[model samples]
Target: MPARPPERTAADLLTTFGAAPHQTPRQPPTSAKRGRVNRPTAPLRGHARPGHGWSPVLAPLPVYQASTREIGGLFPLLVASPMPAVGARIGYDVQSGGAFYCHPVEWVLRNGLATNPNIAMFGEPGRGKSSTVVAFALRMLNFGVRTLISGDVKGEYTPVVRALGATPIELGAGNHARVNALDLGPLTARWDTWTVRRQRDELSSVLGRWVQLLAALAESQRHPPSVSDEAALAAVLRRLVGASDGYTRLRPITIPDVHRELASPDPQLWRDLRYESRHDFLHQLRPMTDALANLISGALAGMFDAPTTVAIDWDAPVQSMDLSRLRSRGDTAVAVALTCLGAWSSLATGLRDDGDIRIVVRDECWRQLRLGPRAVAAIDAELRLSRLEKIIQILVLHKLSDLYSVGATGSQAVAIAKDLIALCSTRVLFGQSTRVADDLADALALTGPEHQRLTGPVNERRGRALWKTENHPAHLVQTVLSSFEKRLFDTNAQLRPTAGRGGGVGRSRG
Candidate 1:
């Protein structure tokens, strides 16, 4: 059926509601002139679109309630000034979207912000701490800065030293490389500038460093050095650098020579002590002699007993002593080697007046403090004098707690450790376990926000760390490395297990 010619549908009526009720097709607006299409136009101030013909509307716009989304908002409300561009490009600033540069010595010296140019780094194993140091050192070389690593506990820095065309002296039992404890090469220039009193004081200072090492050795063996032992050591050192014709005779001294002098004391020196005092002094000095012997002729023999096989060229951009072998021998051997290296490095830097920067890194710093308070004092003194020497010292370890672990909670050892940590003007900390974070928060004097950051998800970013400088807020930085650096500074290549030579691990393919 036609159904009354299909009554007008509701859809059809609704479709034409915006137009005339008669439902006639709307015609496009046209100009009064024939064949000319018309369009609405407005005055504009911006460049016009090429085709679409969109123009700015010059009309009074109505204002509406403003909201964050409507105002083009962002999430994190970060406000930080980028580190000045005065040093090596290490990474990017997370807060300010700027490049970050770092040079511990340069920054401190230039800004006069810190009295000590020493740096302290704490990170868990496998957190890229070593790599950051290696990269920083390599970059520093470009600026003519020289670096000396006093102790490479894991031999991790050998590749970097070699890559830079510098030789790494491997010191341990049976290694041909030997560093004469008294090689004057490091002290020659220093002695030249010294007056009689200064020379005596300098030599005495060296003797004191040696005594610290010996005492550390004794402490490790549960036999702390007695006062008599220390006095005897001072006396022996004075005699070793004895006077010749009213002038102090300076000669190349070996550890063996020092050992010999101790074993057979001068009759006049013995005459000064009472019978009981002499016996006690001898008894105390015996252990020191044994420590010297062990380092000179026992397990660590030949490493530092003779003249240095190869001179440490201060002109070289990088120098590192690979103490991995000695580290394997136990903490005692490492302590002794570290002591010698520290003394030598300090004297060497003192000898130079080039005004160029020098860096000394002591990885696994806790091992050196095991020798008790004397060693700690020696290191503290070195750190304090670093500014005058133009030397920047870096101490790298796992956690801040390591420093306090040397002695009882309230002992002088702990106090010295704390002082040593306090000397660092720049501090870098990687992600730590919750417990370590709590300990460090107190030790580092971290703010509430900093503590939360360290213990929160921000800490989960691998290779990312919080860097703090004097009177500055901590920065969360991710270290950047080039492909070459990634390979050159890899410390775990040897440690990682790989497939067998034939490719599979289960069985050998013969």
Candidate 2:
């Protein structure tokens, strides 16, 4: 062991470290100390003392108590977590800064995020509404879901369809393709095997659709058929399909065939319609017959009056009807074409062997609404039955006012059109002018912040839309398109001469 080191005192340690030991002052007398008052020590270095000239007292802040709802208005970033990372990666959620995904069908079935898979989109032209739809459709193809544009009035979807390696069915003056409005499609393919009850239900559904289509066509001509006309039409359809006497199998029919039968109906037809005589039947259904004749010979002649000339490949990823050729014929011609094509597409899609999901894009659907209340009813039926059909119906329009324009105020057509908004579980609102804000706010039940978002400059940015699912927090989405998608979905080819050729990288934000 080493020799013990000497214990160091405080003074010895301080002196060894080159410092002097602190010294204490002499104590005062007890009498003197009693008279002297103790004072607070000087303030710490670099700190101001309260009540000193350098520091001023501050009043107490009122205790702030606010609900999360009120606080969210001030800080929009405090939003619920984004939707699960499923479906197509559309873009990013503006509020939460997370990737946004949207697949109406998946959202409904998988997560119960919505009550239905139907979506209604409203946006001004050139706001990337079509682009968003095309992007969604293109992405959905990866999931094995097909897309069907029943009627492309502007021919905007032609490139997309062709890009997907499918020829778009072109119908117009110069085009040779034709679609029969009354084609039963595959509705009766397995009729012989189905039970009698199933047959009855199938026939009733088929006949109901035909009646609705005929009524819509007649209404389009400004001569809405009466209840008797509809009854007569149903009787004629049942007879034409050979279901009048409870036949097991049904045959496909055409508009011309129906027109011919109505023009010269047999006694059984009138009797089945419950009319006393042929003359009474003929007089009572003259308006409907004339409407049919007009449809056969008018602008729609040779297009929808004969058998369908185009063969649709059900396995294809995309199928679109290019009605742009008829766009020159006027909105009425295009609307009439849409109504017929809608019915035909419903049947064609129903004929699929595999009950796979499909996205049915109804662009410019407002034109069909302008036809009449019956036409509106046809669309309403489609929306209501989308879930049952395993289809995601996307109805695109310019604005909510387009629905109001279906008829006069307080009219049945207008009411039906307005109800169309409620039928869709998801509503996508793109950029719109301030003029349409009130209608949008009312139609969508938008909150104050949502209304401001729509009317604000945020929406002015193309591809930026507010996606509102049923009772869910609205998602502000910025639809992002890849370089290839930009070229394929370019709808401004005519507007820009260099659009079709290799051009600058296209972003929907433009």
Candidate 3:
């Protein structure tokens, strides 16, 4: 029942116009008579001979990779629009024989951001995950694409980002440097500027309540006494905010008083108190906690006056979305700014024009995908349908286990790692010993040759990766930005020579 033209594919295109493929050629068929290739016979090739004549079923209209808007207006039919160029690569290392080697970080940037089909980067610490992100951000900046480099810690990339003339929007404070957080009222009034103002307010409140409760408990260094204690804590928060309003109606319960009244201890509730809550909360909290809140608020408020990117000037290179310096605040720092910035990037997709919008995420990405109440269906739906419509998600994470916390199944976090890898088109994995590298390779169903490239050689601080795609077979890549590369941009003002080509960092594994 499906219409003809038989769904043209990369293979079909290669066969048609002879797309040059990498690697050696396969043996030609014996019956296919060597040198000269046979051409299909056609009667009246130039002129109409039969009933259909020269119009002989040209081909069912294939969706020839045009913009959604362009396709609707028949741009593909005109054949005037050029295909997006894809040559950029992300590298990884893989093994071939007994010796270990490195490969180039490979990626073909075909403007995947405009449509769906996003990208992902998964690796472990010391694997150069953050370094890789920094290089990509630099590259995007070179392309004139504005970017936001956000993280819980102030970007170690600040020196380099600043060097690029990008503004550094540092959120949270570092050790010895305390930042006085803005209260909810001012924050709400401030944040009511973004397009998602109201919704963002609600989400932040949900996140803030949980975060504050945990903060209070952590402050007490003891278990919360009761639900009343939770209420009391809320009151204390209200009083501190100088609240004459109803929203800041939080009260405090003394820890010792509540602990004495405790009936049964809720271990899960206690644990949820702070080892962590939803990592996404960071985005919600950024406005309330950052010194940049008012600055960002003003920028957002001016948005109704101009373009979104221009309004916030948030995405530009000079505007480094910094989250470092908030050591004392703990996970809240990540929850407020870094996490929210990533979410905002995803939100910004489909809303931009002209330049490509690349959202670069680093550190514990697999862990971030881990969720509590959200639905996997929703996450997958967003990713497949609209998540990357206008923005490309450049996610870099640490471990395979971070993809899914032990029990959080059915949550939006489940199986998304797999979906991401499958649709990634480019999967550049770095150093992760254990079964993670092995399991990921197996999951992708990489061939023996592919496995060799992925598992070839890996180190703690730096390693290579191998990639697989629908069009291209498996290939290997190495971490492009090493620690030495990062130290070059460090503003600490200390200049040190990089480790020599022998690839030793202080001490190497014997």
Per-model TM values vs. the true structure: 0.78, 0.82, 0.47
Model 1 gets an lDDT of 0.71
Provide the overall lDDT of each model, using Cα atoms, as 2-decimal numbers.
Answer: 0.71, 0.82, 0.41
TM value for model 2: 0.82
Which residue pairs clash within candidate 1?
A: 216-371
What ranking emerges by TM-score with the best candidate at the front? 2, 1, 3
Poorly placed runs, candidate 1 (over 4 Å): 1-82, 110-113, 189-194, 243-245, 273-284, 294-297, 495-510
- lDDT of candidate 2 vs native? 0.82
Candidate 3's displacement at residue 296, Å, is 20
- Model 3 is weakest, by summed lDDT over 10 consecutive residues, at 97-106
Clashes of 3: 52
lDDT of 3 by residue, 432-491 (tens): 665787876666676776665555554433645554444455545454554655554433
Q: Write the per-residue lDDT of candidate 2 for residues 1-510, one digit (tens) a residue.
A: 999999985446445544344535434434333544442223334247554432122112123334444444445676665476777889888777788888887778766788899999999888988899998988888888899998999887887787778888889977779898987777656777788898888788878988999899998888888888888888888888889767756877887788888889999788877888999878888888999999888888889878878877777788888898798788889999999999889877765668889999999998998888888899998888888889899999999888887778999889999889888999999998888977898878898888889988447578999999877878888999998788877777555544555664332211
Runs of candidate 2 with Cα error greater than 4 angstroms are 1-80, 498-510
**Residue-wise lDDT of candidate 1 within 1-510, one digit each (tens)?**
555676664334433443323333444434354453343344344346555344443222222233344223222454545456766777766556567778776667676655578888888888878888877788887788888988787787877777777788787755688777666665555666678887777676667776665566556556667787777666666566663324345667676887787777666666654424556546657887776666565556677668878666677788888887776677777776777777766766666768887888888777777666766776887898888788888888888877877789999878989988789988888888989989888888999988887787437766678888866788877778888888776665655556667432221111
